[model samples]
Target: MANIPLEDIQNDVDTIVSEWIDLGLLKRGELFVIGCSTSEVAGERIGTSGNKQIAKELFTSFRKLEEKTGVSLAFQCCEHLNRALVVSEDVLERFRLTEVSAIPVPGAGGSMAAYAFQQMQDAVLVESIQAHAGMDIGDTFIGMHLKPVVVPIRLRQKNIGAAHVTFARTRPKLIGGERAVYSKDQAKSMLCD
Candidate 1:
């Protein structure tokens, strides 16, 4: 069981989300990935324990954030499922992600992923995704899900409960060298062509 109270978890998640938004890491309609270990949050070794209550609290917080930000979430499952993600059908369709067949259970997928799989409407399992921004709680290694050119986004809350957390946001690959301009100037040049 998680020693951390639900309120504390909520507050931590809220702060992380707000900081990411302030840092310009998150935006509306972006795909955000979360890889969590309820066991780690509970102060136990990773994969040794699973806490549904903790998972629920985190999921609720994420739902509130999504409601306010319009950002979609992808919950990464544990290694038993090869770290596949639990995502909504809408996200799957929009990203053209390949769907796999595997219903996540607490032991196999970790509590967070299991909770997400159950709560999401029209949810599906995806083998991989290229998310715009991501948070890895408990060192679940969410890096694989993030897009190329990932930029680490530091947050005020370094850890959520006993779990260590890391965040990152993706950016477009810079194509040109020192003299080349990006963004507005590049767009103007393209228009001129």
Candidate 2:
């Protein structure tokens, strides 16, 4: 396997995250889910070669993102943990999320999650969450954890290291039928009886 410099991983994360932030989708106090596969990021098959070093780099970048945006971070574990999330205790309590029991290791939870579980203060595993926005690294399938009405966000930095990255932000589902007005202008034109 080719060695991937840790700095490369950090740079990719920084660039991708910066692009996402510029999109104006993430908000303060919102939950942001991250699903990553370190093996894939290192140009290997997912789950084949998990690397803690890579996870460390990613965690560092994510921490900066959280500090800058005020968005809470949630790391999704691999299928071995049923894709449960590692989140700060504050977020679990603030959001009233269901707590789960598990200690993530590199082999089971995937590197990114394990690193997050270790580094985050008062980190706890949660059964699930409805994140306001999320980024999927290496096709970890974080859709289930995102809120309803997910909208795909396209970013210039497509891949983080060797991993293909996808981003999304949620919106409230638009209800009502065709007669319902959506925008302020449309509502203004309508006269109530």
Which candidate number maximizes lDDT?
A: 2
Off by over 4 Å in 1: 183-193
Expressed as tens digits, the lDDT of each residue in 1-193 for candidate 1 is: 5567878877887787777656754688899999999899888899998889889989988887687778899999999999999999999999999999999999999999999999998999999999998889999999899999899887779988889999888999998898777879887988899
Model 2 per-residue lDDT tens digits across residues 99-165? 9999999888988899899888799999999999999999999999999999999888898889999
**Count of clashes, each model:** 0, 0
181, model 2: CA deviation in Å?
A: 1.7
Residue 47, model 2: Cα distance from true site in angstroms: 0.8
